[model samples]
Target chain A: MLLSPSRLRGLGSRVPPCSSFRPFTAAAAAAASPTSKPQVYLSRSRNPYLNLSVEHHLLQTTPPDSTVLFLYTNRPCVVIGRNQNPWLEVNLPLLSSLTARTKPGDHEPAPTTIDLVRRRSGGGTVFHDPGNVNYSVICPPESFDRDKHAEMVVRALRGLGVPGARVNARHDIVVDVDVDVDVSESDGNHGANTFKISGSAYKLTRLRSLHHGTCLLSSPNLGSIGPLLRSPAEPFIKARGVESVRSPVRNVGVGNGEFEDAVVAEFAKMYGDPDVFCEVGDEAGAVDGVEKGMKELLSRDWIYGQTPLFSFSTYPTEDDPRERPSLPSDFHLSFEARHGQLSKFTFVNASSAGHVDIPSSSSSSPLDGSRIYDVEDWTDALRSYGGTVNSQAETAGRWLNGLFGTGHAKTQLR
Target chain B: MASIARCVRAARPSVLSTISKPIAATSRPVFYRPTQRCFSATPISEVRKYTKDHEWIDLHADNKTAVIGISEYAAEALGDVVYVELPEEGATVAQGDSIGAVESVKSASDINAPVSLRIVQSNVELEEKPAKINRVPEDDAAGGGWLARVEVDEQGLKEFEGLLDLEAYKEFTATLHE
Candidate 1:
């Protein structure tokens, strides 16, 4: 099952075969072999797509009974759960504008453009940057316990002098910090001291169970996380998938190297010294399976089209009846999306235009079979209705385009 | 297939006695629909088999239909399922292929097919009430926890024959805990 040297050389022509490529490929092959000893890996690449694909490859190809530990850091990204709705969980408008914004009062330039990713694991959305380190453990299903790895990370934190670190009931690692606040306003109602430092999620197959978590160490973008995760369309869309439970989060105040070393030490205590410990990165994309998985992860279909069924109503309905935020126009519009395709759209009240049954993917109309992410201009989509854009249509289209991050005019955050 | 069906029927009472409740103990009613040539044959029976992966399939007497679902053991282990992503109806799959997945406790676990099948219908109601799977995972009744109804081919039947019986499955799970 291991990638042959000849094949690795063929796939990785971009990487010099006589140099570090040999060790990387050897480590990967060792990790992939069923009979090989337990493995540990550290990724030097900051590409979120590559990191996830590499992790997934390890999850699939690693020995069924053997345990694996992978540690890596992504540049900056917003990663959503496999079944979560991007439009409901993420603020698309703000996310699209992040490249132009910098930390408040910081002299350093803004970080690179944030990449949006949809991970195969199921959980709420999370923000990742260089200050955050992600640790993944893949082990046999019989040995899988949700809190096992989280507790290990807590032990690592405690070793690093973070005395308040502990695993919460929800299987996340949190740190208690003294704060002057009312007990009712704090998360988990455990007074105001509890703040999550690591969020855990899992992917389970028949043979292997993979537990991965993000530990916020010293992220400068903590200020932007709250706004980035809060979508303007949250009040309007009633989604049919896992919704995130908001938690107060903070950094554990440790360097990435220090944290990684401590975690590896703790892992060694649990499972003996790794047989192979090496670095992997962009060269991993050279492997055929990894390349394929990377392509799938980077695909538009998996990112947007994999979203579960959801409905959007301008006014409160039976299923999602919360007082909706006020809008510029009083146009009562409703729609439903299945797999990110606009399946149904209705103009319940369009000012003078009584009720108009617009065409969705399920019916015949200008917006037939349109993928929500592909529609860059909602006004253009609505213009085909009645051959002219009315006031109500214009107002709704502009608002929706903004909410869905497809607006023609990108507002510079600078 | 007949021997397996008989074994399942003979073991039904013990199977009911083994599992802890609030697990609905009522077995799905297997009606005897006469085949074109076997009009005088006794009531047709369905055979239920369990996979080591913790899925169960109730193979119809016709040998060409089956209802698939996760076992009660799996449902209890996966606390509070928030969403069930059902497979695409009519998609042909091999025995070990991942047909769909369930999201529970911040984890998404693949639900593999117990046998080769062409999906006919999925339990769409699970999309809205995912907790039903936890409440009655082995129930195949209407509005129950069954994941799909699929068309089983000869290969599928062969695979189904190899799966563990309820008694054997109970023993297998017992060993895992030990």
Candidate 2:
């Protein structure tokens, strides 16, 4: 059954063609009756996968002429891209083991599920917390324009009296923190462009495509994000997945209590008719599809098993000479993986340079500051440590006596 | 290797599980071939034909099978290929339908079927080392850098005729880039 904009409040059980909405062009948009802008859905579910499923559902089922905007939130989690490696993108060990305490020091109510998930789009990874609001735009392939949506976001933020909200060359919405310097004049380092207010990604099917991004209305402070992003446990991990560029991010609605509603109102005014909004779960049958999509997204196979083939290696040297001169400089751990599965795993104290290469593990270390863990045995630890790419790194940490130093660290999968 | 096929199957369970028309046609592991090595047995029998989307399908004398891959212009345009999402061996595709995608530093482009055919073998080497697509000589791309082998009978051969010859496709891509 075809869905007219009027029927959006309810739906037939059957899914429609990819281009099931009204045939729309800019001229047709102007001449069209009533639904002038886009269809808006506000998702109440905080489950990260569920919210993503809702966006994919709309993208998969929506008509070409129709434009859709999904504004939702997720409980804290790290989301990977479709073609990314979780081992390199996130600190997998911290994500799997962290316990979100319901009461102080009580591990029983550990509700924290800070795991990695792969999104069906091409871009870098992103972080989501309850304080962050995500916006996704699904349009016809011809109608998809990331710049327009970026402009709309900046325009909406400006309407909320937020200052210095503008899109940079990378198409990220950055709020200039420095009062003295313009963003363009600053160095290209993402860290210098503090307070990345919005991050976006895009995907295309044969018929329609969608562009989705995160908006920081208010969020747990930026430092809380570093843990989910990467791990300090491993000194460094090298992989070739699409790595997320890191920039200091800030909450747009931090001081203003009304900022969430204000930003929503602004987006509704710009992208939708305030009257034509749909509360995602309000429809009865749609929840099943969202639930299915949610289950699909939450699967371990989808999350970890989809990562591109990569090799990750870490060198453990003197972390800080002033603190611990006892630690030696030549210890290294390396692993090769395809789809997050390990192929070659090795750990060695190479006194000789370039002795430890995968499928050939040959290296011997002096008894100086480093105690020998025997290069031959750690391979078993890494293979057993494997569920996600991040887990393997954690196994290396455990077997070698946490040489890299534990605790959460975050980095992109570049 | 079956491992790569297993990985692809796991990654795209929904699509592969649902499509019942094509039998699993992927070449099981014969042995590890170097990414740079050209298959000496399957040389191009006929001149190359190009799809508007930049894929070149070389149908040797036996019109029943053809080797297909992206064009030199496409390889040049795609920049460095970080990943290539290949189709399952048994999957059957209609002309112009997307079988898989090729991801580069720029963006991911859908790999379309130039004509209706059954996938017989996927280049597992590309899955292991995607840059090989860029490494193969551009002039010999249709022979050296092919992405997959597809089954083409008389009907598939008729469909191949509608595609542009090498010179026409080069001219076509020129107009697009300009």
Candidate 3:
């Protein structure tokens, strides 16, 4: 349905998109219309998968030209880009350890299950918690701009007295914090005072464009984020997809309710008051396609199989030459993986009498065709290669196990 | 050359300029050649055809295969493409299926199949240097930003016929801006 500027004049009062609308609808089963109105939905579901599914449903079912605003906050989770390599981007071992922590701590035991999600968007990885409010804007393809809504968020932050908040060159919202120049410079890397408060990513289908961002507001896990996002294999792996640009982040010092309300007001300023404003919960799963989308998001295939092709090398190679960290054994190991399956592999034990390279074709090693996610022990995976299982090999395996998040059960989804 | 599709330039530049233009833009035709040509084959249109979604397909001389890529306007609108997730070769996709996806300006946009076809080859160069897409998004040559080469079937030919020609696509985009 094509809408001229003139036709959008009076339709503001009653935008016509949702097939059925109640004050607090259980599901989001809206249909597209010629004369569509702007819609706003605030999610009560803390499940990242469910919230993402509802967002996807809205992106698919909304009118091609209508604008939408969806606000949701998920429990502790590390969300990666659609095409990113999770092993390279996230510290899976750290995630597993935190998820396994059952002991009661000063603060509740570190989130029992921190979900590892691969979102259907493109960008670097981000850490999301209940303290972080996620806002999504979906509009027509022609009207899509990466920074347009991010700027609106900056306005919202400023409205909430974050006067230093502004959209940075990378489209992330950052705040300029004043620091003692003498003391900060003593730390050797204190030139920039800006701390990112929000990070943005986008997904564009044929008909609609969706931009979503994470606004950090009083997250207790801020200190833990650095370790959780840093991977042990970062130095040894060369990946093909997007890599996260590290930035110092801080909270906007506002409540989630205040941020959400300010953002909604800013959104209303841009597209007029929303025709459909309501809060949706897990009941959104009852929508026509939300269940299927949630299932896909939760599947191992989508989480691991969607990774771009990448290569891992223990020693320095010409393609990715750098000073190598000393390994326990003088082992030369390298492999190429596409879609998380080992396609080619080479393992050599230089410590043995005259280093012998184990060609993957001749060796019946279990690592071949093995999904990286399923490997529970790198030592066992390497022990079956018919070589002397020396302490050096065991040590190398233990290091690899830590790097690859092996030797522990995969974290269960919450 | 007539089979090569082209699109109008998008008026607005994308928000992010992080994607630097590729230093070299080379036309290296890297596609599988079909030897057999049927004389009684239906005469497929020689001109390029476009989907409303901003994808374009150019039928090969054999009329059984075509090359697909996003339009120039789409490339400009997408800003600098950082990566392209190429579809697996030898995979058959129905019409409207996502053939691949392109990432630019932190946005992942699907490049849908213009018609039902079996992909035979993909542009691997774009995987290494994605900026080539911003430089030559419509170039079907080997090093060009063309996404894939697919063998079309009878139904694909019918679907192709329904796509908009270059002129109609121009008018359609104009209306969108209006």
Candidate 4:
């Protein structure tokens, strides 16, 4: 049975009626009728949260054997894997600094913030901005083919001028930067050859599967996005989410008009009639699931707490105020975080209050004549003379967590 | 709910024949505590049915419990099992609902419930070593490939009406290659 509009649109009241969006759904009644084309809900929503909700709704509501395409672009957001930790995936400090300056140099009405969204599919975190476009293919699990879905984008891009566009073994659509397409050789000096244009991820159910990905177009400055994609500031994460490898990326067109048209055409040829395709909401929160997805994606719990359990160890360097001149520079803080919550916090000071002469830290530095109790290892470092490690762990946990405690999912990139 | 004794009775030879192994063809001594034979072990011993989605349920002697897992064909197709998200304990799931998921090669496949029942226990060993499913999916021994144990009874067997028998499932998967 197909979902009733009310059942699907129970979350509708939260979204305003879209002037562009038609109220049609793949209801059982519609499925009961004949002579209609395979419906494509081409949403106008730019909100990533809403766009993804539409994708999920499409995946769940559509019949197992039916095929449909969903297309949209989101504002700047860093979406991660369902099983990944946000702390490890996003560069928090860098995301906080993006100026929401539009192309004409006017700031958007809303303050610009990098969003953190965990996708149901398993893949590395990705960056999305208004300049990028996303497409998802929902079909029966038996009919779903990974390469076939990715090939649509490759063909669409090639038709729009990227001749060298090809899906790599990693399922990324890449263009060799060094080898010019002779069309749009990059004008930047990023010192990278292969620029990924599209990255794909998939989620499967008993009857159906959905494959979705993004195309980097002219809006996002690929060079600028590189900083936010870097590893976290503290490197305290060790979770099992697929890590996003830093690859050189490129935007195909300066504008999305040609590319979007090509996509709509290719999907129609491959799946149904192009003329049948109709546009949906062109604004954020103009459809269902946006309100629910936003609440979860915007929450500290889902973004940070969903991170896989990890352990981190930090040690103080030479500038610690609690350091004694004759003491070794080994003050370590061992910590463990589960679902992004600190589970174990410990502080160890493996220094003996003795003046025994020890070698300097590394080959570069010369040791003063004083005794050095430098802790070289946490497992087998110098024996603690008279300090408590548990108390130190608690003290350090409070201090470090206070500085980097829970905050909004919106973070700094720079 | 008061129970007399809990024992793992081995699946009968007819059910074991579904596995493509030499031992399956032979009359292997199916181990069982001779004491529990007083209950209705006949229903489960007769055969194991498979869902179209490739899950199988092996009901026990009492007919109130079942061990469910993906078929060997599914394990083979999924490549190496990296993670298995088993259903939570005591979660009452209806027939046809997804109980959990199995992630392999970065793609996750939902594991569905064949019968409406509450989850009794999940294979905790799969949490650390999911590859065990991939290694010996056809094996009936402990920690081979079973995903969960659920509360099922004579009425639960009614849910298996539309499911395929071992031979039928094999035939269905054969058409997949075509």
What DockQ does each listed candidate score? 0.34, 0.09, 0.36, 0.19
TM-score of chain B of each: 0.81, 0.69, 0.77, 0.75
Q: What is the interface RMSD of candidate 4, in Å?
A: 12.3
C-alpha TM-score for every candidate: 0.86, 0.66, 0.84, 0.75
The sequence of per-residue lDDT tens digits that candidate 1 reaches over residues A1-414 is: 333323322333444332235434555577566676667777888888889988998888777767889999987788999999989998888887775223323546475777788999989899898889999998877677888889999988998899989999888998887766433322334555788889999998877888999998877677678888999998999998888888877777688877887887777778876665666767877876678887888877888888998999877777788998887786666778888887666653445334453323455555646788778788777766643435467877889877888721232121
Best by TM-score: 1
Q: What are the root-mean-square deviations of the candidates from the true structure over C-alphas?
A: 7.3, 12.2, 6.6, 11.1
Residue A248 displacement (Å), model 3: 0.6
lDDT of 1 by residue, B1-178 (tens): 1111111122224333335333463567666654444222432235578888878998766667789998877776666799999989989999989999999888888899999999999999998899998888899989899999999898987788799887887776665443
lDDT of 3 by residue, B8-27 (tens): 12445331221123212234
* lDDT tens per residue, model 2, A90-137: 665556565443222243634655645678776777877666778777
Instruction: Name the regions of candidate 3 deviating beyond 4 angstroms.
Output: A1-33, A99-111, A181-191, A351-365, A389-393, A407-413, B1-46, B167-178
Please give the CA lDDT of all the candidate structures. Answer: 0.76, 0.57, 0.75, 0.59
Model 4 ranges off by over 4 Å:
A1-28, A34-36, A97-111, A179-191, A233-236, A274-276, A282-299, A314-330, A341-344, A350-414, B1-19, B22-46, B138-142, B153-155
The Cα error of candidate 4 at residue A346, in Å, is 3.2
True contacts kept of each: 0.51, 0.07, 0.51, 0.28
Off by over 4 Å in 1: A1-36, A100-106, A180-191, A348-365, A387-389, A407-414, B1-44
Q: Give iRMSD, candidate 3.
A: 6.8
Clashes of 2: 11
Candidate 1, residue B13: the lDDT equals 41
Tens digit of lDDT per residue, candidate 3, span A303-389? Answer: 888888899988777889987777766777778888888856666665542445444457545567887776678777777654554
